[model samples]
Target: MNAIHNTYWLLAAAAALILIGIGSSLLARRFGAPLLLVFLVVGMLAGIDGPGGIRFDDVAGAYRIGSFALAVILFDGGLRTRRESFRGVFAPTLLLATVGVVVTAALTGLAAQWLLGLGLVQALLLGSVVASTDAAAVFFLLRAGGLQLRSRVGATLEIESSANDPVAVLLTTLLAEFLAAPSGIEGSELLRELALQFGIGALGGALGGFAIAAALRTLPLSGGLAALFLGTAALFVFGATGSLHGSGFLAVYVAGVIVGNRNVPGFANLLSVFDAGTWLCQIVMFLVLGLLATPHTLGDALWPALGIAAFLMLVGRPLAVALCLVPFRYGKREIGFIAWVGLRGAVGIFLASIPMLMKLPNAELIFNVAFVVVLASLLVQGWTLGLAARLLDVALPHRDRAVRRVELDLPGSLEREMVGYAVAPGATILIGTALPGWARLVMVVRNGEIHMPDVAGSLSSGDYAYLLAPPGRVYRLDWLFAPPDEAIEAEREMFGEFSFDADVRLADVADFYALPIRAKDAPLTLAEHFARRYEHTIEVGDRVRLGPVSLIARELDDDGVRKVGLKLERLGNVLVRRPWLARLLPQRFVAR
Candidate 1:
């Protein structure tokens, strides 16, 4: 009875922690801060030094829990990474993941050793710990900011961040072990170890992924059960790979990707379960890490930590990105944005916990410094990331996504769509207003709490509500949810291959696509230039064809043509006209 009572108390504490963590996330979101940063702050505030005064000094437990959390997070990242997503950016992504990471670690190691006065091995280990750009942080901020990036640049950064974690993990583990041992590290032996670890990791992950996909295909289970089974298999892969001294992280991640891409039973449920689990794990992991940190020691570690962060952000990250992407032909602006967005979060902190668990020299200090680096990254870099993207001229205009989403269930063969709405500030959707006949308000999430508001409850600003609605009525929902000004700004549909941007100059773009921009000397916008020769009736979606090029009006307001999309047809005819240029078609002429 006493043991059961203790268990209940633990559960109570966990529930409270989660509740507080969520509140912190909301506050952070409101203040334009990174959610993970707030989570860390809240955890620290609730710890021994702060008001809550809850003592937690379990380094080993935190390490174990954090590792498990990372495994789940990495697996989820892999699961969502579709093969088609990396189509043209694979080479650059691979280089950034492998070569860029190594350069970052080396440069950071040098800085740490010089400034922080740690020994070479220890400094190198610290470098390795923080070298990884946090996949969760980058993925979350980019997606949340609603910034569309030029395809190759965005995809490369996302893929690099996700794929590079395994490398950092491997380096951290090996370096940690090296620091713990007295044996002199030989160059040849180091190379062999690196090769072996990477080889086993890649091979194991590929095979494990295939195995998981095959197993899921053979066994048909209910959604919940299928997700449980998939989670179980992931754990199994991680454990089994570890038993063979392989990269368990890589194995788990690859398995997730393969399983995700395959036609698995209960795929949506799997994604949903993993998403929830990953969030929970992230919270618990960060909180536990914060609890482990002694606030008193941070005062001394703060300056040194900031110095290291400055060097990494200002010097190491950019250097690495530029060097690795040199051969890939990425523009300087795109590279600059990518360099600035290397926000360190959970992964760095997790690696920091390792040194503490090992009880290495100044382990506590290392942990403190590592945590501060994450703080600096998330607070400084993460906050300014979107702005930097815009300033660097690499940002894409946000694409309007389908607000209506449909999910189909197999057993019942039922199809359903849940349309989400954000009641913009000052937008009035009356509590008792009659909704469209095809729609029904299901639930409202206000200040992070879910409430099934009906006629009795008020709909106020910032309330995110969901509705079950037919696909056709999704557009009409704008008037109900969007602010008056937003409703006016919404663009009508356009026709084309959905290419190019509104902001680009026609003079700069004319010769590239061989566009029919006759007035090359005139300073005209893409939409403005196209509108002059465009004979089609001026509606929002009028398409104008000129030779092999197609131009479509993407956006229009009260004024005139706002944005135009361009698509160049096949260049076979162009190549036929100039036979000698046929050999360079795909490599040169067809680049646009």
Candidate 2:
């Protein structure tokens, strides 16, 4: 009877902690606190060291929970990552994920050895534990802060955060093994292990991802069932990869990317389910880690942990990022922003658990110090992320506001989704913008009454319009429904005053504005110039400078650039206002 009562009490406590964590998120967002930190604090408060006085010290249990939670979180991150985001970023991102982790670990290990007085191997283990950026923390904060980073910077960070975990995990495990049996390990064995971890993980992930995608497309599964199937299959892949001594984290994340990029039925449903699932996983993982930590024990290692955290954030991360990104030609601002966003969260704490599980020397010290480091990181770096992005000029100008969008799966179809949007006042569609040729309007809801597109005539403010569009191409429709103010602000501020057809000859524009043009390049059109300048596919917002003027790609299509916006590089405000006078004078004189 006492055992049954104790079990009931444990269940209630767990439920209460989770609920409190969820509720505290509102305050975290309102105050710009890191949500994971809030969850961690809640669990700590309920632990034995805190007022709640719940005595729980279960390292093995916490490790199991953390591993599962991390797998789900990584899978969710992969599913949301669009394949187009990888264009022109794969090489740099890969370097950051692999070589960058090693550089960061090496730099941080030196600091740990000096501060914590640990042996070389143990110091490197400590460094590797906290090396990789946490995917959960990065993904959550980027969305919560409402940041629209430049394509290159954002994609690199997202992919690196997801991809680097496997490298860090491998490093930590190898170091822990070395500490456990120093005489038995060798350099050649370590190299072989690293190769197998990556090679096998990659091959397995790719195969599993394709299989999952194919099943989702062909199976007649409902939305809920499809989500469950995907979650289970992802875990299966993770387990299978680990059983083969490969990096399970890498396999699961890669599988997620493949499945997400493929055309599968019930994608919207999968996203919605995983969105909630990832949140739950993060909360649980943080809570368990928090419960595992004893705040009183952390006091002994607090200062050293704080020192290590400070060094990692300032010197270690930035130096590694600069070294890794120099060959890639990343701007100073981009590199700085990426280094600043290298937040350590559950991954660090989870990795620290391995030392405890292995019973290595100073294992308890490592866990306690890691706990402090995570806390300090959340308090300092997480708090300043938004400001850093803005100060460094890495965040892109806000061009779109969120709108009410609903996606519905079409039965018997894997290619199309029925997307619905609430037409806002001053929406481009409400004005004169036309839907793409591939999009077909099906229905509209006005005043809670549903009507066919023909009967509805034209969409009005507050009217809900539904259209069938290819899943991959639906994002292109968002601009048509964007709020008027953001659209106007974007056009006026970032895109410039005048728009023209992209097919216009550069020679004609140069003659009109008195721009200096080389004889060889005089005959090139704006589209041709963009194609020549950018090696990858040209996207909207891409800019090419021609002497004093900048040509911005304002619109795109299957063929190439459709429209371009001209901005005076130096005298944009002054010359734009005096358009007639500016046209008459040479651009050099206008600049003076």
Candidate 3:
């Protein structure tokens, strides 16, 4: 009965923590905040430092949990990554992963030594902790940003984060060993061991990938079973490689990619499973790390942590990005965005625990500092991501999924397939344009409303164009959905999806559309004009629709909208049971 009670409490505690995590994640999503931020904060709140007073100080247990979480995240990253994406920016991204890690480590190490007054190895260990761009954070940011990057830049950053994790791990392990003073290990042996870890990790991952893919293709398993098999195989590879002193990160990731890329029954469903599992893993890992830190110790190292974080952000990252990309060609803005976006997440904090586990001097202090750095990175870099991307003109309007997915559910039929594509701005094909003989345009979904295109119609930017095509010949649909061919793609200034040039002013916007703007609002800048209307903070991407005109907060900080984009609708297009009903509603209502 006592055992049963203890088990019941354990289950309840786990359930409560997980519920908070999920709720926090939903809140983050709604507010355009980083999900990891909520996870970390909720964790801190659940720890000894907060009211619940849960005391968790098991370093070994934390490390073990972290190891599995990292493996799962890596595997998911690898699975989702496209080979073509890698092929597109291989040279620069590869260089960035390897050379960039070295430069970032060295620069950050120097700063740590100077700022924290630590010894060489200890400083380097701190450096290694933060050396890699976190795959988990970067992946989430890209997905949650609700914007698609220009293909090259997005792919490069994604690949760089995944590719560099092992490098950072190796560096941290080596530095921790040296810091703990096992000086008798020869340089040659160290190199050989490092080589073995990479070699075996990659090989194990590839083998696991093939095995999973083969099983998926041959077996008539349900989606749940497939997910179960995939998870089991992934964990097996991670464990196998780790036992052999190999890079478990590399093995699981490689395995995931191999399985993910291949066409298998329930592959899409498998991906969804991976995504959920990865989220759970990230939440658990970060929460445990947060629980490990004592709030008072973190307070003592506060200033040094801030200084080191600043150095890493302002100096170390950009310098490393510039130096590493010297061999390849990337514009300054792309490099700048990349530099700013190198967020530290689960990996950095996990690496910080290594020194503590090894009983190195100042290990707890370093852990505290690492926690601080992760906090700063997520809070600053993560928050400003969408704004920075737009300001740099590196983001392409993400219209790729304009339509809600529709399935035929036809009995015993495999010939016909349904597909959805978002009509990008500047697309050449109009709505009424004829599709290929093999396919038929079925529906258009816009602004959360679906309209069946039973007759020919014109398509516009942000319109979800749904079509049906014979599965084998669906390739022809690409031509119609492709963006317009133009001499140079103009970066249209967006005020809510309406495109205008920089010279366009508030008065011009009102006058051109015959919309009323008060004399008080006339002189306000785009960002300032919107600021006058909101009673509360307006986050980036928040929208306020004024009957026919929409105002979107394009660039936002703590100070509300830093930039605004406007969209105007033809007054005639407004639909109402009684036209006066539209006129009676509030002119502006904000959407979360």
Evaluate all candidate structures by whole-model CA lDDT and list the values in order. Answer: 0.73, 0.84, 0.76
Off by over 4 Å in 3: 398-433, 436-592
Candidate 2 per-residue lDDT over residues 328-369, each given as its tens digit: 878777888999999899999999999999999988888888
User: What C-alpha lDDT does candidate 1 achieve relative to the native structure?
Assistant: 0.73
lDDT of 2: 0.84
lDDT of 3 by residue, 150-191 (tens): 667788888889889888999898878876676766798779
Model 1 spans > 4 angstroms off: 144-147, 399-489, 492-592
lDDT of 1 by residue, 81-167 (tens): 766667867888888888888889999989989888889889988898899888878777777667666556677777788788878
lDDT of 3 at 173: 89
Per model, state how many residue pairs clash. 0, 0, 8
Q: Point to the candidate with the largest lDDT.
A: 2
Per-residue lDDT of 140 in model 3:
83
- Give all TM-scores, in the order shown: 0.72, 0.80, 0.73
Query: Which candidate do you rate higher for TM-score, 1 or 2?
Result: 2
